[model samples]
Target: MASGCEKGEKVQVGKSDLEEKILETATELFAEHGYVKASVRDIAKLVKGSNSCLYVCFKNKDEILFRIITDVGSDLLNELNKVISKHDDPVECLQDMIFTQILFSIGAAKKMKIYLEEQYQLPPSLKEKALDQHRQLYDLYYNKICEIEKQGLLYQKIDKVVMTFGIFSNINWVYRWLNPIGRLSVEEVALQITDMLLRSVLKNSPLST
Candidate 1:
């Protein structure tokens, strides 16, 4: 019943505290063992609840996976839209988009991992719903690229889809390498990536100014 939770963090959709705990534990297990390998019993064991308790909240493992993916995708879109609304300058918008996404991905690295990796395991109907969320996220970046192109700052030679996915390729896997407690803070890593990405796609790197 929670509409949304925190920015750059897992959004809680579970109705009860126990439901939230199941979601948290399930995300860790799914990210670690994959959706197919991780079972309802595995999740229930981790939550110290019976499988029936899990069934009470979620009909099946697929439902839990669907909820996690939906919540993460929705939270990410909300954060990205906020960045888009906050910045009038296309260059700045693009820069913050990179930062915001990287920040969110790292913060919810496990859920993002499950989202990127295991979402295909979902049944067709649920998969399409999840894919719709992904497409919206994709368009936010694609449209921002168009904005930059309109400003005559984007490098026109690169296909916009390629440009958008290139940025995605750069940021999407940050969860694999980023060390949350390592020398660099999350913001620092996000900024470094933003600078690197902007330098490649923009005619004039905004960081230069």
Candidate 2:
């Protein structure tokens, strides 16, 4: 584990693989129970470790939640970049961007759950990083919207800033109620949300027709 776990991009992570294992377990545990209710022991038990072993891998439970939040955002941004790169037209990029975000958020429900519901568990240092990542996603959406409007592919009347945030807030908020086993599939929900946003905003635009 030493050779494998020590290769983190940042720190010389001791038992890094075990740390990820513990984090995966704790993410699910905290997502279901919230940070206050879930314990380090539960996470340790999930990973077949003692409490002290868990602490050696992670400073505390708050650090676990912080890691979960940032990891989820990292996963989300990676997917978003991959999906958006498939298109060249700014309008298609914007539309595809919406779909990309919806799919990532719904598919990565546990991570989304931790980020949206359990971020308060993070210490101030990690909390700021998580919030910064969240804000960057917001800025990316706004910049995309501005680019599309400037290209005349989007309705000029649209308040690109507010519309950008509105579109993101509406779509990204789906993780809160999304169920992996629920009536709607992830793709289905993405379609529904995308359609709603399009009809509301794109409906008034010339390019939409």
Candidate 3:
């Protein structure tokens, strides 16, 4: 009798809450005192776990850093996919992407800071792989923008590469100054940014109106 198990299905095993706490502590430590300066002992101590426990979860500091980067990237890509899949209209898709990204940035500001500022501190091979992951993300935005243009929604013909870069620059860097405890909530800020970007690109959406 043939069972129902498939060959290519991916099984996602959830991590323990304690392990999640360890990663959270590590993110704070790395952000506070650069990735290279933050030691595994510091992370273990803050997580209230022994060095051996960290070793059980991660091989070394390098593995921890890679894991943090990989985890955040995976989440962002998954969310981006969801936003992309939900909308048939490219303009709405990009707006949702911007809003979702802002919410992600606000919620994971510390992790975002560490991911952006600490990439070079990773080992050479690891750094290369991490950067390649980043490039893949960039390509996603580029392709999305290109698809939008193909629909003739853009008012003018602009360079796709430069436009993609511009869009990322216009949105992603907000992590540097966004305040979670500030006057505006994450949803509010995301709405404003989404409006700003959508008005910039959509032919029917004007900035002044």
What lDDT does the true structure give each of the candidates? 0.87, 0.73, 0.76
The Cα error of candidate 3 at residue 100, in Å, is 0.7
lDDT of 2 by residue, 13-92 (tens): 45777777888888788778888998887876676656777766677777778778888888888877776688777666
lDDT of 2: 0.73
**Model 2 spans > 4 angstroms off:** 1-14, 156-158, 181-183, 203-209
- Model 3: per-residue Cα lDDT over 1-209, one tens digit each: 11111124321223355567678889989988888888988887776656766665677898888878878877888889889889987777787888898888778888888777777778999888888888888987877787778888775755777777777776778888778788998688778878877776667664347
Pairs of residues clashing in candidate 3 = none
Q: Supply candidate 3's per-residue lDDT for 51.
A: 71
| TM-score per candidate | 0.89, 0.83, 0.84
Query: Which model scores highest in TM-score?
Result: 1
Q: What lDDT tens digits, residue by residue, belong to model 1 across residues 1-119? A: 43333334353555477678888999999988889999888887777666776776788898999999999999999999999999999898888889988989998999999999899
Pairs that clash in candidate 2: none
Going through the candidates in order, what is the number of backbone clashes in each? 0, 0, 0
Worst 10 residues of 2 by lDDT: 1-10
